[model samples]
Target: MANRVDTLVATSPIKCAADKFYNFFKLNMNELVKIFPLAFTGVEVLEGEEGTVGCVKRWKYIIGGIPVSATVKIEVIDDAAKSITFAVLEGDVLLLYKSFKATLTVSEGSAQWTISFEKSTILTPPPELYIPLVITICTLVDAFLLVN
Candidate 1:
């Protein structure tokens, strides 16, 4: 099966719109993505540009023991349309959804950012997959206990 743009979702944990979310993620992108690193552990950034290396940031991500790795070469394009275009240079799954470019537009303190993810299969396999049903139920129970 050929890799394609399989899934895309916009999350407003803070209810920020396009430009806001773009800037938010741009500033805190590293921190936000750190969640995945912490979850799986043994992940490392072998090489990457800190940020904005002449309009392009090169990022390299490696998960320990996983045969797959990703290197995204992101570039910001300021255009008449006022949107940023992010692209993946070379890495795993390049054939299936190799690049992603989107724009962030602000609307009432919330930004509507469109994230386009490329994938070969609808079932995009991760290195480690875990079921969260039990954990979610336990978390709800704990929250209820705190509330009551």
Candidate 2:
């Protein structure tokens, strides 16, 4: 397969540490993001098991109804070093990029979050794929605060 045309590195405005926002964040991350889909909008969490090793949060989203879909299984690897890695499994990313992943590490004294994505999607995505991801992420976080 050919390499994707783009790789985006998005940095968060605040630190990614164990705080109130972070705490509240865990309540429903997978579900919150799916509320924006114009058609299919639901995320089913298949598994959520946390232990001394790390936490595995697996989820998949069904978009544009049942047939059309894009799924994501995220393994949240939390280390004592104050860094977390989100390893994505299955879906288009798994197909185009065998080892697709994203990482969020603590920076600026854990007061800021730096997210870097290593993608293997099409050189020029149809925009639908990435656009929804960003919009969903932003909308979800925004809703988190407003609702609380």
Candidate 3:
């Protein structure tokens, strides 16, 4: 069978500063559950420490009103570029993809999200649904940051 590797990218303009938005994901990821209870149910540090490379986190988030979880490892953190990359180690996402990685990049006025993956089988659909999910999260976070 042929390898089905693909990438999806999406960008959204945010109200917050680039560094502040990046820091929220980099340093204060744990607070996501508390700040957005409807979108995220929990975020637990399974290995290593938060805001550091090699940290592993188990995230429980909502998709289509259903709760889904993913275990991911922090693969890269580029403060200069304001980007963080996460490798999905396991969980519901793995069921559809043989390999999966996501990168979030924040710039002066916007945030870009990229998802790279290899499908587990030809029958598996591309992760198109995640585009809106990430966009919604970005919009919500932007609003939350503006108010708080």
Candidate 4:
């Protein structure tokens, strides 16, 4: 089977300040998960401490009636650019893809802030089947930022 890499981008507008949204993802991800339990069932730190690159977090949640969990490591954190990148080491997407990396970014706008998720996944067996989950998470993040 040939490895296919796919990049999926999902953007959404938020009412909160760009910095707040950026920091939430970069620093307070665990607290955010607690605040929005509906979006994510639970998030546990599997290795290292939070808020720094190399920290790994395992996320447990349900997707389409199926219970899924994924362990992702913080790959890059650029505070100036308001971006964070996470590499999926195991679980969920790993069943199909050989590797996956997701980068989330927050940008300021005149009236509303925007959050974008750029997911690059290397598929092993072909056809992209897991992108909707990323989009759903981005949508949830967008709504969550606007409200709280």
The top-ranked prediction according to lDDT is 3
User: Model 4: clashing residue pairs?
Assistant: none
Better of 2 and 3 by TM-score: 3
Count of clashes in candidate 1: 9
**TM-scores across all candidates?**
0.43, 0.52, 0.94, 0.75
What is the lDDT for 33 in model 2? 43
What does candidate 3's lDDT look like per residue over 1-148, in tens digits? 6876799999999989888899998998787787778888988899999999999999999877778999999999999999999999999989889999999999988999999999988888888889998898898888888887
Better of 1 and 2 by TM-score: 2
- Higher-ranked by lDDT: 2 or 4: 4
Predictions in order: lDDT:
0.41, 0.44, 0.91, 0.67
Give lDDT for model 1: 0.41
Which pairs clash inside model 3? none
- What ordering of candidates by lDDT runs from best to worst? 3, 4, 2, 1
lDDT of 3: 0.91
Candidates 1 and 4, the one with greater TM-score: 4
Over the full model, what C-alpha lDDT does candidate 4 score relative to the true structure? 0.67
